[model samples]
Target: MMLQFEGVVATGSAALDSGIGHTALKTLNDVTYLYSVTGPGGGIAVWKLVEGALPQLQDTEYFSGTITFQVGGIGMPATLAGDDQLVLDVRTATGLIGYDLNPDGTVGPLQETGTLTGGGDISALVQFGDILTIAHESTGQIATYTVNGDGTLSLSASIAGQADSMQVLQAGADHFVIAADATTGTISTYNVDQNTGALTVVDNSDALATLGIASPTAVEVVQAYGQSWVVVAGAGSNSLSVMELAGDGRLIPTDHVLDSLHTRFETVQDLAVIESDGHVFVVAGGGDDGVSLFTLTPGGQLVHQDSFADTIHSGLQNVETLSVAHVGDELQILVGAQQDEGLTQLSVSIADLGIVRDGFGTVTGTAQNDMLSGSILETTLMGGAGDDILNAGIGATTMHGGAGADIFVMQYGSDPTTINGFQAGTDRLDLFDYPLLRTPGQLMFIATEQGAQIKFLDEVIVINSSTGGPLTSAEVFGAGFGGPDHIPVDFGDFGGLEPGSSDGVQGTVTVASEAANPGLSDAEIRFTPDGGGTISVRADDEGRFDLGLPSGTFEGELEIIKTYSTASYEITALDALQVLRMSVGLDPTWGPATPENLIAADITRDGMVNALDALAILQIAVGLPTAHEAEWVFLDDDTDLSGITENNVSYETGVDVTVVDNVISTDMTSILLGNLEPV
Candidate 1:
C-alpha cells in the first residue's frame, strides 16, 4: 500500500474568521463533489474533482452570501435519482437550505425550503432515497422531510430523540436509522415505516457501560464479510466500538475495540467507511493531528492498518470530519479540520490489502487449485501453488503462475494478455474462443524474434520464451485435438533448445576505431535476452568474436563497453544481417555484408584506397602536386619520411672523388603507401 500526500486547500471566510467543520461527498456521472461547511460566515463550499496529471480540485461555489448563517452539516444523494437532478441539502442554524447542483458540480443560489422551530441546532443530516433526515442536537429530535422535484424539502415526520450524529441503513425492504447521543453515551436504533415514514423504536444499548463509548460523537454503518456492523466514535473516552446489527435492529457489541491507547483517536469526531475490492476500511478523524485507519476482518474484528498525519497542515486540533470518494480507479480521502481551516486530500492504494481491482469487479485466488475469471475492467489473476485454470474476458489482463503447471484460456477479441513464469512442456494455452483447429487458415503461427506470434485475424498473441529460441510448429500446436471449437496447445520443449545446436544462432562481432586500425580488443559485450536473463562475451585480441545463442527469435539490446567509451545497439533475430560486426570505417554492419572485409579499410577517407594513394606518395617523393588531402602528406619532407620509416633505413656519402660503383636502389614511397588496403 502506498500513501501520497496531495497537498491541501484552504476553506474559510475572507475575514479569517472560522475553520471548516464538516464534509460530504457526492459522485454523479463520474464527477465528484466535495462539500464543506466553512465556519461562521462560511456557508457551504463545493469542490469538484478535476482529472489531470493528478486528481485536482476546482472550487465550484461558496454560498456564504445567499445563506448568511452558520452551516453545521451537509448531505447529498448516494445514488443518482431517476429525474437526473443533482441536489444538496444543508443543515443551518435557522433551517435546512436546499440547492441544485449544476452539471459542472457547482451549486445554485440557496432556497429556504424547510424551516425548524424551537431553537433549531441541526448537528447532522443524511439523505436516503427521497427522504432527508436531520438530527437536531438542541431540540433533541430526529426530523424526516420529503425532497421535492425542484430541490426543495417539506416536513414529513418528526421523532423525539437526543442524537448528536446519525446514519441510515437499508436491509432488504426495511429502512433503519442509528443515532448516537454524546450526553447520555447511548446508541439508539429505529425502524422507519416505509409507507408513512414514521420512526419505530427497536432497541437501545448503553455504550458507556459495555464498550466504554463515552460521549459518542459519530456513527456509521458498514457492510463487511456478509454482515452489517455499526461503528461508533466517542469524544470523551477517545475510543471506537464495533457492533453487529441484527435483523430486528439490535446492536450487538463485538470484541474489537479501538481506544486512544492503541490509536490516535483523541476526541474522535467523525467516521467514514471506504469499501473497495472486498475490503472494508474505516477512517476516523478527531482532535488528533491525523486520520486512523482500520480494516474489518472476516471475523468482525477491527484491525488497525495505519495512520496518516499532516502535522504541519492539520495539527492536533479539532480535525472534525472526513469523507472518501472514488474517482476513476483512485480512492481519495478528504479531511476537514476545524482549527486548520483547510482540507487535506490523500491518495490511497489498496494493493497491500491483498485485493487487486479488476475493471468493475475484484478477483482473488487461493493457494489450492482454483479457477479465476476476468471482469469488465482490466484484471490481474495470480495462480498461487497448485495447477489452476485461468480465464480472461474482453478486458486486458496480466496472469502469473507460481509453482504447479497452469492453463490459460484466452477469449477472442479480448485485449492483449501477458503471461509470466510460464514453464514450457508443463503449462498449456487454450484457444477456446478462436477455434483455431476448425479453421487453421484463420490463425497464423509466425515465428518472431521475441518468441512466437499467434496471429488470429487482426489480433496478435505473443508468446515470449526464456531461452531466446524460436518455437516450432510441432512444439506449439497440439498433436491430438479433442474438439474443433477448442484447441489445447502445449509449448513442448519450446524454451529448452540448447545453444550451439541445430536450433541455435551463431554470430561474430568486431570493434574498430580511427585511432586503432585493427580495432579495440578485449571490449566487453552484454546481450540481454528478451525473455529473461543476460549473456556476456569479450572481444578477442583482433577485435573479432563469435557467440552461440538459442535459436529462437531474440529481441533485446546489446551493450559494448571498452575503456572510457560505451555504446549500445538494438538487435532482433528477424533481421537478415545476423552477423553482428562494427567498425569505425563503415556505417555499421547490422545487416548482410556488401563489401565484406574491405568496406571498413578505407584509411585515406576517399571512399576507397586504390592506386590514388600510391600516386599521391610518388608525387610527394618527387616534389610534385599530390592528391593526398588528409592530415599529413606522405614522403614530402625528411621528418615525414623518418616517421613513416619503421623497419629499414640507409644513408651513403661520397667525398668529391668520382668512383664507379654498382648500387641497388629501392623506392621508399612504394613500400610505405603501396600496401594500403580498405577496411
Candidate 2:
C-alpha cells in the first residue's frame, strides 16, 4: 500500500488566532477525534474523522471557554470506563481541567478537577491505566491523580522533583516514568506501582548529569527489537540522547548522541514516535530545521534518517510539536509550528516507519483458484489447499503454498521473500515489473556469503543456500509471459559481458591545478598508444573527459594541452603521484620552476595557487605511516635528487637538505619541516 499526501486542514479561528500547542488522538467506534489545545487564548479544538476507505474529516468544534490560562498539556486515559464516553484532561497553568467528550464530537462544560499547590505551573501530563501524572514546573514536583468513575481526578501522591516534561510507559506488567528537569539539565527515573498509583525514585542522585543534558524539553518511550528505549531531546544543547530500560526499571545511557550539526536538532521542542508493523521511527520538531526523522535500532540506538526542511517542505521554522497516528492504513504526521499559523499534515507509508516484521498475522486463501495480495508490511500468506496466486507487495514476506501448486508473483524493489516448503518442480516464480528473461545477458546467478544472488542488472534477489546451485529458467518467467514457451534454461547462459565491453579499460581525465581555472575548459586530451596510434578528445567545460582504451597491459603517454601550457605524462601506477603533482602545477622532478606550472598547485581547487596546495601535495608524496608497503617503496626513490625544497625553489640552498627515503629515515625530518621530500 502507498501513502499519498492530503491537503492540510485548519483547526478554525481558535487555533489559527491563538496558536496550537499540543494535540492528542481518541478513537471511539467508527469515529476518530483529534483534540488540540490553543496556546494563548486557552481554547480547545476537536476535529472528527469518519473511518472509511480513507478516513475523512467529518466536523470540527472550537471551545474557547475550556480553561483560563494557556493550556500546557492534554491526554486521555488508556481506556474508557463508560459506554463510548471518553474523558479528555487538559493541564492549564495552575489547575487541571477535565471534559467529557460525547460520541458526537461535542464536549460538556469544562470542570476544574484539581489544582497544584503554591501556584505551580503545569508543563505536561501523561496517563497510564487509571492513574494520571502531571509535571509541575514551578513547584518542582510530579503529582499523581486517580481517575474517578465520574471522569474526575483526585490527588493520590506527589513526588518532589524538578521537571518540565514527563512520559509514562508500560513494559509487560510493569510501569515506569521518566521526567526531564530543564532547570538542572538532568533526567530522573521512577518506578510506578501498578495497583496503588504511586511513584518511587529509582535514582536519588541526578542520573543524567554525566551526559551533560541541558534544557531537555521532551521525552518519549519507544519499543523496538524486543526492548524499550527512552529518547530525550535537549533544546539548550541542541542534541538527542537515547537510553535503554534496564531489567531493574532504571534508565541506562547508550552513549549514542546525535548533535545539532548532524541532525539539525535546533531548539528541539517536542518529540513523537510512530511504530508501523515492526519498524519504529522517532520524529522531533524544533527551530528552523522543522521536523527530523530517526530510526530506532534493536540495541536501543537512534539513527538519523532525514530532515523535512529542504527535502519535504520549507519555511517550517520554529516547529514546536509533532503528532503521528495510524488513520486507516496510512500513518499521518501532524506538524505544529510556532510561527506557522496552521498545522501541516503529511501522510507516509506504514512501511516507511522502518519496521521489518514477519507479517501482519496470517492470511488464508479460499478453495478453488483464488488470488490474495499483501501490503508493503511484513505478512504471511497461506495458499490453503488450492491452486492459489499470492502477491506480496514490497515488504519482507513469507509464503506457504499449502497443498495445490501455487504461483508466487514477485515484483521489482520487493524485499527478500521466502517460500517455505517449496515444490520447486511444480510451483513457478512470476517476475513482475522486471523483464529478466527478455533482457539477454542481464541476469546472473552468483555465489555470495549469505547464499546466492540472482542479479538482474543492478538489482539482486538473494536465495539462501550454501551451495551455488543453478535455478531452472522455467522456474522464473519474464513479465507478462507465463506459458509453455517459457522453458527452463541455464543460469550460466545469461552471464552478461563485462562493463565497458569485454576488452577495454575506462578512466576519467580531469585537469589538475592549484587554483580552479575556468579558462582550462576545452583542453585537448591526447593519448598516444604504445603501438604508434593516437586518440584525442576535448575536455568539457568542467575540464573532464571519459577515456576508454582497448584491453592491453602496455604503457601509454598522455598529453594535456591548454592555452597557457602543455603537460606530458605517462599512464602508469607509479606515475599517479607525479600526475597529481602535474595537475597542481608542481614539477615531479623539482628541477625547474614555471609560472604556468605553479598555477596547477591550487589543489584545494579554490581557484588560486597557494601554499595550502603545496602542503597537500607534500602530504600525499610522503604518505602516512599506515600507508601500504608499496607506497613506502615509492618514497624510497633515492636516485631522484629532487629532495625537499623550500617555497617551490628548484635550487638546493644552504638550508639543511636531508635525502628522505622511507617513513623511519632521518630525511623525513626535512619533509615534516615543510620541505618537499619527494616520495
Candidate 3:
C-alpha cells in the first residue's frame, strides 16, 4: 500500500484525558464528525471534520457535559431504521450506553443503558444494523444484543471465549464476527443469524500461538483476491498475522510478518482495512509511535509497503486507535494517539505492485502527484501529469516529466540520467546527493547538435529539448545558484543537406518559367550577406544553382541579378507590339494587362514604362543585339501584383530565405525579357 503522511491535529478539549484508545466517525447531513474516547478518568471529545481545501478537524465543543466510564469505551455509529438521526453506541467495561445524536452536530440526551451482569471488561464491540456484538476480556464470553427502538440492549446469545478485538464479516448470505483472543492467543470465528441477534461458534483455534503471536489486540476483515481474510495485530509479539476465512467460517492461518526497525510495527494495536480501486489495503497503528501499511496480493500474500514513525513528525506516539473513510476522493485514515494527545490524518493509495515486481522497466504514473523511483537496473520513469518526484536508481535511466512541474533526483553511483521534455524554469534537477556537485557553476555545459549536456566528474545528464532548440544554462538548477543565466556556447556551423555536411552550400535558388514560356536556362543567382558583400553564381542550363555563400550569421535578404541573354530568343515582333500597346492605355493583344506585364515592358530596368523601353524589347525579340540592365525580373509568389500601371510598378526582387537544416531552397517566378504574355 502506498501511504502518505498528510497532517495532524490535536483533540482540543481538555476534559478528555490522554490515552485516546478508540474513535468513531458519524456522518450526518453532509458533514462528518469524529468522536474520540480517552482512558480512565477521561471523557469523549468531538470535532467537526472538514475535508475541503485542507483536510482538518475543526474544533467545535459540541458537548461540555462529560460522561464517566471505566477505562475507555469503544464507540461506533448507527442509524435507527425509521429515523434519519444518527445514534452513538458506546461499550464500556461495565455496560453499554446509547446516546441520542442529532443531525445538526449536537449531542442529545442519553437514550438508554444496559448493564453487563457476569462478564469481564468489554474489550471490543461491533454493530450491524440493529444487532450488536461485544467481546468480554476477563469472562471469555462473546455476547450478542438486540438494540430496541428506545436504544435499550436485549441479550440474544452468548458464547464462551477469550476475545480481545472483534469485527463483523459478511460472506454471501451468512454473517460472521471474527475475533482475536489475546489471553488464549487464539483467533476465533462465530456465525450470526440475521433475523435474531444470535451467535453460534463455528471455528475457534489457538493456531496463532504456534506462530509466536501473543496478545493479539486488533482483528480486521478484508475481502480481497476474491476471498475473505482476517488480519490480526499481535501486540505482545510485535507482529501481524493474516488468516484465510473458508466457506464454513474456519480461519486458516496463511501469512505472518514480524516487526522490524524498517517496518516499525512495534506494539501493534489497531488495524483498519480499506478497499479502493480494486485493491485492499490494511493500515496499522502501533504503540511504538509508528504506523505501517500493507496490501494483500492476488495470491493471498501480505506485502508491507511503507511505514512512518513519530520521529518523522508523524504524530503517532502511542497510537491506539485508527479509523478510515473516504474523504472526498481520497482515502484518509484518522489516527488517535494516546501519548501524543492528538489525531493524525494520513492518506493511503494502492501501490503499483506490477512495477515493483518487474524490478526494472518502464513505469508510468497517474495524473495525481506521484512519488516514483526506479530500481538498480535499466529503467525508464514517466510522470504522466501531476507535479512529481522521480528518483534515478543505479541504472541508465530515462525520465520524462510529461506535463507538470516535476523534480528529477540523482544520487551517487547511478548511471547517467537522460531527461526528455524537461521544461526549463518549471522542472528542476536535484543533485543534492551527487558527491561534491553542489552548485550550477561547478558543472560544465557542452552544446551538441542534438541538445546540451551537463557533466561533473564522470556524471553526465543529457537534456533533450522537445522543441529541438539549443539548450542553455537556464535549464540547470542547484543550490547556491543565482537566477537563470543564458549560457552561450559555440553551436558550430549548422551542417548541409547530409548529416555532418558543412554549410558550404549556404543557399540554393531555383527559377521556373511560366506554364507555356521558355525554360529559364543559365540564370544568374546573387547572394548578399547582411554586412554588404555580394557573391554571385551562375545556374546550370536547367536554371538551378547551389549558392556557395560563406557560412556565418547571414539573416537578411539577398539580391538576384541576371542581365539579358541574347542567345535565347522566345520573344518576336508580336510580343514587342503587345508590350508597346500595354505601355499606352490600350490592352495588350496577347492577354489582359497585369503588374507582371508592366514589369516585363520595363526593358531599360528603370521603374517607369514608355515607348523607348518597348523599342529595346522589340530589338532583342528579333535577335538584334540591344543593351538592357535587367532581362528577367523575379517577384516573390506572395507579392501583391495588383493595381500597377507603368510608373507605379515598384518591383520586389529580393527573395527572403534562411538556412534551417544547413540548406535553404527558394523558388521564384521568372519574367523573361519583354515576354508580355501574362506571367
* lDDT scores in order: 0.53, 0.51, 0.62
Cα error of candidate 1 at position 553, Å? 56
The per-candidate count of clashes, in order, stands at 8, 24, 1
Kindly list the per-residue Cα lDDT of model 3 for residues 400-476, writing each as its tens digit: 88787676766444568888887877776766444434367888888665567878776788887666666677655
Higher lDDT: candidate 1 or 2? 1
Name the runs in model 3 displaced over 4 angstroms: 52-71, 79-95, 114-121, 137-139, 149-151, 204-210, 349-679
lDDT of 2 at 327: 70
Each prediction's TM-score versus the true structure: 0.49, 0.49, 0.49
Which ranges of candidate 1 are over 4 A from the true structure?
11-18, 50-55, 60-66, 73-95, 114-121, 148-154, 206-208, 260-262, 313-317, 351-679
Colliding pairs, model 3: 140-161
lDDT minimum window of 10 residues, candidate 1: 662-671
Question: Which candidate comes out best when scored by lDDT?
Answer: 3
Model 2 alpha-carbon drift over 4 Å, by segment: 1-6, 12-18, 49-95, 114-121, 150-152, 204-207, 259-264, 310-315, 351-679
Candidate 2 residues 241-335, lDDT tens each? 77777545756565335444435457788888866666566777778556666555443445444555523443255777777786765667676
